[model samples]
Target: MDYDDAYANVPHIPDGESYPPRWAAEAAAFREARATDRNDLGVSYGDTPRQAYDLFRPETAPKGTLVFVHGGYWLRFDRSYWSHLATGALARGWSVAMPSYDLCPDVRIAGITTQVARAIQNIAESEPGPLTLAGHSAGGHLVSRMIQPGLLPIDVTDRITTITPISPVSDLRPLLHTAMNAQFQLTEDTATAESPALMTERLDIPTHIWVGADERPVFLDQARWQADAWSCPLRIDKGRHHFDIIDALKDPVSPLMRDILG
Candidate 1:
């Protein structure tokens, strides 16, 4: 089925290789420009080095907290590459937390899921008010997993107001045939267990599935699978591909931000 090519995003997007460096540079500049008090860097959520998260606070009292998880197919990228994404939420008076979890090959997808859960629990402890979660790609899968029963503490789950999984991999069974599965080491059992689309019950949290209209057909299908499974609203952002779809997170007034923050 050429699952690898089906899931591949970079080659399909024009000049996609350039996006990472640009994201890193922009994120660095954002960190440098932000007030020291507003940005809390390298806050530990777990013992491992990559287990920490970057917490960005707003100028006035926060209305709530939004935790954003980055997607590198569970292989590449970290919290640093996404610090700038917090701008929109911060501007809207919401504290934003971006966490970096250990990637695949170093740990299984399930382990990465556990790390994110701990990171969210850690963030919720200090940040009060309602909570909203948003994740991209592999991260979208992780955030969706959070709504599963008993995955997070009851208190934390109760505070969750909404979740938006952008271009999420709702079903993992397709990846079993991919070459990357060698690194992922996902068994049929594990793949089904990790698939958010397979769940019949959720935590009653409001969920919205988002995907780029211009994304590869598989991604669009994955998004639709999730929306159908959860019976939730799905939004297709016109003219956006996978890489650029997340750019709206930088704008407070953008539909994505308004949907998540409001």
Candidate 2:
């Protein structure tokens, strides 16, 4: 199989190149409208400049905290492009935290995983209550890794109520065959080691795998592989593709929100 093409998303999605700019505009508007009162921007979670997170709080006291991780295959984008996605969870009275991590070729995927864990730990320390996580694509893989034994503190893991990995890349072995592997630098050992689907045990938290019905077939397979491996539920949103499947996250009452917030 042509692994590079199989994993590629832009060429398949119509006008996919337009999404980043649109997301940037929407996120900028969201930040301006929400303001600094409830929206805390550029809060440092680590020493590095990229290791900051944006926190969006609701009107009333939050019932819990939801951490949403953005995806760019661990290469591109940042927390700034995804502030609007916090709308649904905030409308449901949950605080949302989005973190930016150092991308690949600058830092390895494993390093990125550790950074996400630290970001979540930082959020949990200040936010309180149950923790719900939702991540997209590469972010999905990161959230799934958090459930692996010893990856996170027991206190933090115990507070995690649920996790939803949307269009996650569960297995890294196949990625070694893709052109992007040059940036990933994964060996046979590291690929298997980083694969959440290859894990023998996880934190026992409730997990739900989500994929778009119209997404590339490999993503569907990846989601299924995680669901099966973790013995969790899986949802395929109808009429949605990889690029647009996460759009429902802006709707407070959308099924995707219900799945994440429930």
* Best-fitting candidate, scored by lDDT: 1
User: What's model 2's overall lDDT?
Assistant: 0.93
Alpha-carbon RMSD to native, per candidate: 0.7, 0.8
lDDT of candidate 1 over 40-120, digit per residue (tens):
899999989999999999999999999999999899899999998998998899999999999999999999999999999
TM for every model, in the order presented, reads 0.99, 0.98
Error of 2 at 4 (Å): 0.7
Q: How many steric overlaps does candidate 1 have?
A: 0
